[model samples]
Target: MVYTAPGSAAFSRKRGSMADKITAELALIDTELAAVELGDIELNSGEILVGNAGNVATAVTPSGDVTVSNAGVTTIGAKKVGKAMLVSESEAVAGNIFVSTGADSAIDEVAVSGDATLAASGALTIADSVLDGSNVANTSPDNVIGAIPVLYRIAVEDASANNDITSTHKFLVTDFWFVGGATPGVAEDTVQLLNGTNAISEAVAKTTDANCLVRATQLNQSTGMIAAGGTIRITSVKNTNVAGTAYVMGIRVA
Candidate 1:
């Protein structure tokens, strides 16, 4: 039988059979329910299976923040939210964070709040960089400032030439020494300064000793002997010794 809508309650009660048929036919319309309100709702398994937006289980509040519990995967406003973490075991992190589990790891820019301590497996080098510090500690080999100019040691010995009174023999001077002798009689076993060789103002010579002796000379620029490139030769004039020694100590000014 066909049912007609009327405003009066009597019509509804009288058409009770028609109403039952109408309700059955309209069951599909009820599936498209608008909103639901409930004190609490619990689902028993197998009773309801929620489809995509086919059904909306929960909705956002007016505040725009969402909280979920025990969800394996969820999404909010296009951002995927996972349960605990987003883990990448095989994939790599490009852009800023680059991590190589096996070989190399590098970060483009890193900022630490306090001091930074770096530990390296191999040698760590900060090349072509200036370290601003008042003092520097050198823990390597020998530290060299500048070159020092100094005569180590000198020695003197007998002359190699035979009776060469007028000629001068090249005596290997071990250290700075002097000897002297009388006029023309093998000179004198004396410690006297040579014309251009002796650095001391007065020539020093030993009148009697055959052994070599040292002559003190000023360690300054005024003393022509032992200057920068100047060589001081020890000559055995009256003394037979042709070997002597001289030690020089000076700093490199230039």
Candidate 2:
């Protein structure tokens, strides 16, 4: 209420009677705002004092939290804050949650289906390396190429007799072999090669002397043998005086 400025000064009312009627209505509105213009002066609220400033450019309504302490650079445009929690107990650097372009980066490239469990206490680092199963290729039917563990080669031949050696005969040697004719003892034939079928390896014999060859070697493994299963028998013998023919081959190894 005491603002004088026009035609010089002197509106200083030191005492009070409501400070001399607000110093004569502020010296008649400072002689009409001193002929206006000072950027046309506008004060729409309670406090406005520019010159020796105490900066307070606030326009707060329903919007609250806006704190800038040791300010160096704090620029906020459409500042709207309701719940924005940023807490740090000890180490808080830069504080970044800046993700620029659209829809949260396509929802972070989603593709999560089955099992992904990592209950770690510490060390877990997977960079880049590949070596799946090393080398694995297996075909069915009588497969016995050195048994099984990390197999190398297996192709037990059957040509067309198609008995197919009951598929690669993996270790089941039941000890029984005899196929003799032509004077080695007139006639002797008994072949059961292996029994106790679980993964198969059974054999018997019948020949019309297409070259007569049937022999069984030490073929061993008892007390429940299975490192992949085990058995081996390969024989060949031919002597024709009238009847002679036999062929048997069984080999298993793991």
Q: Could you tell me how far off, in angstroms, the CA of residue 162 lies in candidate 1 after the best superposition?
A: 16
For every model shown, the clashing-pair count is: 54, 13
Task: Write candidate 2's Cα lDDT for 87-200 as tens digits.
Answer: 342432232222334765531222222233122233333334432222233323245444323212112222212212232323323333334344331122223333333322
Per-candidate Cα lDDT values, in order, are 0.35, 0.35
Worst 10 residues of 2 by lDDT: 151-160
Badly placed stretches (over 4 Å) of model 2 are 1-9, 12-103, 106-116, 120-254
- TM-score, predicted candidate 2 vs. hidden true structure: 0.19
Q: Relative to the unseen true structure, what is the C-alpha lDDT of residue 38 in candidate 1, on a scale of 0 to 100? A: 40
lDDT of 1 by residue, 11-122 (tens): 4555458867568546534643323334235544223324547576544322233433333233353454342234353442222232344535522322222233223333
lDDT of 1: 0.35
What's the residue-level lDDT of 8 in candidate 1? 57
